[model samples]
Target: MEILPADLQLYLETHCDIEPEALKKINRDTYLKILKPHMLSGHYQGRLLSMLSKMMAPSRILEVGTFTGYATICLAEGLTETGFIDTIEINAELEELLNQHFKSTNVEKKIRLHIGPAAQIIAGFDGPPLDLVFIDADKKNNLLYFALVLEKVRPGGLIIIDNVLWKGKVYGDAQDTDTKLIRELNDSIAANPQVEKLILPVRDGLLLIRKK
Candidate 1:
């Protein structure tokens, strides 16, 4: 759920830098071809991801969810010449769609897609410390993913968790599984002394956590 009104969202999009041509095409295609296009990060969030990546300029980025590859491409913008991004998506059906777009993008060389449970895949990555980590996959596993990636993320690196608001259900009376899980994750992050966090009510809600 959006925190701002429609007019405000439109104004924000108009004022921010637009996404690259390739991302635009990919986003459109994903919405048209995919069954659940809403899962793909649209323009505004994509631009935010790109901006964060640019600011971090991380050498290694680990993304827990790679739905349609929109955010993957956005995050790839911040990589150094030889930088790399490892993105994991549990849905095998999106593999072909993701690879199709990945092949057509300029940052194709920087992204590596892993299809499987992120929990298992993350265990095998023995690479260098991550400069940035994005968690947007299974809601129930947010804390699990965060713990798994914490060891790999460099000191002061960033960890962005998407869908923390759960479409305003977080603040409502609903007690569904996903809602409870997100609430637990949010409270845990807030209480954790290892990092500093802020919940930006942007597109659902983005929890920006910085390792201390």
Candidate 2:
């Protein structure tokens, strides 16, 4: 899904936020121990997420996919003094590793990891308005996820959707199920009048939607 050339991507990471020692350990362990380590937003993207979080300094953050807690910790770096980022991971098996890494970063107290389908938790949530949201779970549910969180996000809040490009298939003629789902979501976002959006051609793609 990496559109950038290898050398350029490497250079960007080198110049970006020095992946902290704790985050470095999480990155290394994710590659060595987790399946499909590519899904664990690595150095460059993690730094971008961190930078965005720092800029927002949001008090309520929601992350749909908490793969190995890599991005989770990154987002936690820029929370309000009393802020918390609630994340959902469907796979219960990774709970142990997720908790271990979260603890290692000492951000466990700032993170609330929910184990189960994201739709349930998001739809039932009655917490304060969210200022930031990161959606990186199942591609098929991207549209549903967006809809569920839109009402909860305060006006002017940001909802960042990862992998909106679906490895460039969304723009291609590939009519595969996943690509079609992504395309539908992208088109819907483009047509929606309640928000303004942009697709940053980063790793895969990130569609940033800011509510009006």
Candidate 3:
């Protein structure tokens, strides 16, 4: 769900750095082939994710969702030479598409695709200190993922949570399960003392939390 007005979104995209040719192709293919094309990070949010990743210059990154591998590739933009990203996707069906997308990319060597339940993958993860994490998976498990990720993220590391606004349902009196869970997670994160957090109204809404 686009939180920004269409014209405003277009203006923002126009002003931001141009989307890379590889990313543009992925965006086009995603819309043509994916079931929920909106889930793709698209142009603006993809640039934001890339910018954040570039800013962090993390040695190790964990992404909880790998929808179409758009954001996966974006986040890889700023990884150190030895840095690598471990992105998990529950749908094994997407593995082929993701692999195909990563095959010719420069970040291919820096990406490790995991096809399984994010919880299980994260629980067993024993990688180096995580410098950053991106959570864009099941809304109900947002807190669970946050807690799990917080344990592995080093001090001062960052965790990015997507869809926190849930297309404006979070502010309305929508009693739906996803909305309630997202609202609860939002409240919980805001109250948590372990990290400093801020929500950016980009795309659906991205919550950036830095471990303290």
Estimate the Cα RMSD of every predicted model relative to the unseen true structure. 1.5, 1.2, 1.0
Pick out the ten consecutive residues of candidate 1 with the lowest summed lDDT: 1-10
TM-score of model 2 (CA atoms): 0.97
Tens-digit lDDT track for model 2 on 1-212?
Answer: 35668998999999976988999999999889988888988889989999999999999999999989999999998899899999999999999999999999867899999999999999889878999999999988999999999999999999999998877899889998889889999999999999999999889899999999
lDDT on C-alpha atoms for all candidate structures: 0.90, 0.92, 0.92
For candidate 2, what's the RMSD?
1.2
Q: Which sections of candidate 1 miss by over 4 Å?
A: 1-6
Question: lDDT: which is higher, 1 or 3?
Answer: 3
Quote the lDDT for 165 in model 3: 88
What is the per-residue lDDT of model 3 for residues 2-37, given as tens digits with 9 covering 90 to 100? 567899989999999999988899988988898878
Over 50-69, each residue of candidate 1 has an lDDT whose tens digit, in order, gives 98999999999999989889
Evaluated against the true structure, the overall lDDT of model 3 is 0.92
Better model by TM-score: candidate 1 vs candidate 2: 2
Which stretches of candidate 2 lie above 4 Å from their native place?
1-3
Model 3 has a clash total of 0
Model 3 / residue 129 / CA error / Å: 1.1
Which candidate number would show the highest TM-score if scored against the true structure?
3
- Find the 10 residues in a row with the least total lDDT in model 3: 1-10
